[model samples]
Target: MSSSVPHAKPGGRAAAGAARAASPSIIVIGVGMKMRGDGGFGAAVIEALRAYPAVVDRVRLAACDGEPARMIDLWQGYRCALVLDAVRGGSERHGFVYRRELDPEVGDFGAQPGGTSHAVGLGAAARLAHVMDRLPGRLILYAVHGRDFRLGAPLSGPVAQAVPELAARIGREVLGALAAAAAGAGKPAKGG
Candidate 1:
């Protein structure tokens, strides 16, 4: 259950060099099933990101089955991580994108049970990981509203359109984080 996601080169060889220069990495976990309609949003995002190797390398990528226990194994050791998935049952309209920054101190993730397929939601797993000291220091969840969960159905049109845009946004965030980390590392120690 070690991370098999390689250090991807977003822009190619030149980008790989840049990635090597920058530090502090981010992990992106996509949770869903490819066979299920829009429920497969997470895998879609991961697929879109695969086009950018540099981005893929900078960020650890995981396509999960919405199983909380298995997900913990993929994210261990990372300080910051982002999770992408499909969700239902919120005030948000279908195709709506939502972002939630998790607070490790919060025991209850407050995630509505049916939003995702797992018996224990991503939030509860996160809380459990927190208790076990396995949770990342900073974690963000980005959920895309799903319109269908039918087995073997293709992703709905609207959700399909959002995948590339979401991937690009995540790419920018990854680069920004790396840049910030590099800048911070270059700074002299406060006490020195």
Candidate 2:
């Protein structure tokens, strides 16, 4: 699933159609340091998602260079927040993933703050959100195992492969969240 380029660019028309009105209810954020090898996984996955406009136009998308304050602000008022980043030092091998929900309900946010490759990563942002009472209704993190953070190096093989998979999964997440919200509001989901 991993590669530098998006799987396809044929969705240009669909992507263009995403210019419809209405703010998105969910925000998908990719947090990473683009200059560092696998450390840029978050940003890479975000680029891959450009292939899916149905998902793109339905949600707010952002790429953060691992700034805690900015990250917190991006998800401030959204109903749901999804974070994509790379991590290290887990019992699992390279490319292993950790998915957690940390919000009104804890969904096993068990990974240590130190595991992240970011300098002042989501852990600090989560802490800030906790203190400020600014967490979204739903907050999820998809952290993929990685290494080779050497500057100017491209993504590690494993991390690159995970990009497409994460991109597609995140697309599903955006759409599904919209569907759920529509059902809750008793209306058809926009652009579904």
Cα lDDT tens digits for candidate 1, 1-192: 223544555688677546434634577888888788988898899889889887866777777786777777666667788898888767777777777888778744455423874456688778778888888778888888887889999999888988998999989888888888989999999999
Which runs of model 1 end up more than 4 angstroms from their true locations? Answer: 1-24, 107-114
lDDT, candidate 2, 96-174, per-residue tens: 7668887454433655533888777787788778778888778889988887888999998988888998898888878
TM per prediction = 0.83, 0.81
The candidate that wins on TM-score is 1
- Candidate 1 lDDT: 0.77
- For residue 75, model 2's alpha carbon misses the true position, in angstroms, by 0.8
In the predicted model 1, the residue pairs found to clash are 7-57, 8-53, 8-54, 8-57, 9-53, 9-54, 10-53, 10-54, 10-55
